[model samples]
Target: MLTIIPDLPDHIFGLRASGEVTKDDLQQVLLPGLEKLSEQYKEIYYLLVLETDVRNFTAGAWVQDLIAGIKHLTEWKKMAIVTDQKAVEKFTDIFSYLSPGEAKGYKLTELPIAIGWLSHKA
Candidate 1:
């Protein structure tokens, strides 16, 4: 399941996930939000909080996320992934340069700080 984190500024989009995420979740929740943000802003700051209960993403969902990122490559300004999983942290650190803008991985406990850093323009 995925739930939006409300009360953020217009340029930031936040979500918290739990359990196994499927392709439909991306289609139903993420896609619409991304489209809306694209219509309103030149760039978006995405914050994804991967809770411990969030086990993993289905293969199709993972693929969908990849496709979505590629499809909106230039629209992403910053991506902050809050996950305690070592693998996720390592992967983000390794591939951060691949992002169109900046990318950072943080522990779940540091979510607020991550948001602050991503929202910082300079």
Candidate 2:
């Protein structure tokens, strides 16, 4: 399941992912928020918290994610992925350089700090 974490700073877009995520979850729960934020802001700060190891993503969801990232390439301001999973952390570290703004990974215990970092101006 993918859950939206509300009440973040106006420019921060937050999501908590648990269990398995499907294309429907991305389409139904996540896309609308991104669309709304895009309308209001030129750039977006993103916080993705992996509450549990993702069981897996459906093939369609993987494609959707790629499409969204490409479509919003320049709109990303900063991105923080909070997860205890080592592979996830490394994945973020490896690809972070591709971001126009800062990108980092944090342990789950550091979620508060991640939120602060995302909300802060760079």
Residue runs of model 1 more than 4 Å from their true location after superposition: 52-55
Q: Rate the local accuracy (lDDT) of all candidates.
A: 0.83, 0.85
Q: What lDDT, from 0 to 1, does candidate 2 have?
A: 0.85
User: On residues 7-85, what C-alpha lDDT tens digit does candidate 2 reach at each position?
Assistant: 8998888999888888998898778877877789877788899877755777887888887788788888788999999
lDDT of 1 at 101: 77
Give RMSD to native, each candidate: 1.6, 1.2
Best by TM-score: 2
Residue-level lDDT of model 1, residues 22-120, one tens digit each, is 899898888888888888886778888988444478888888898889989988888888998978877777777887777888998898899898777
Which residue runs of candidate 2 sit more than 4 Å off their true CA positions? Answer: none
**Using Cα atoms with residue i matched to residue i, what is each candidate's TM-score against the true structure?**
0.92, 0.93
Query: Residue 37 of candidate 2: its Cα lDDT?
Result: 79
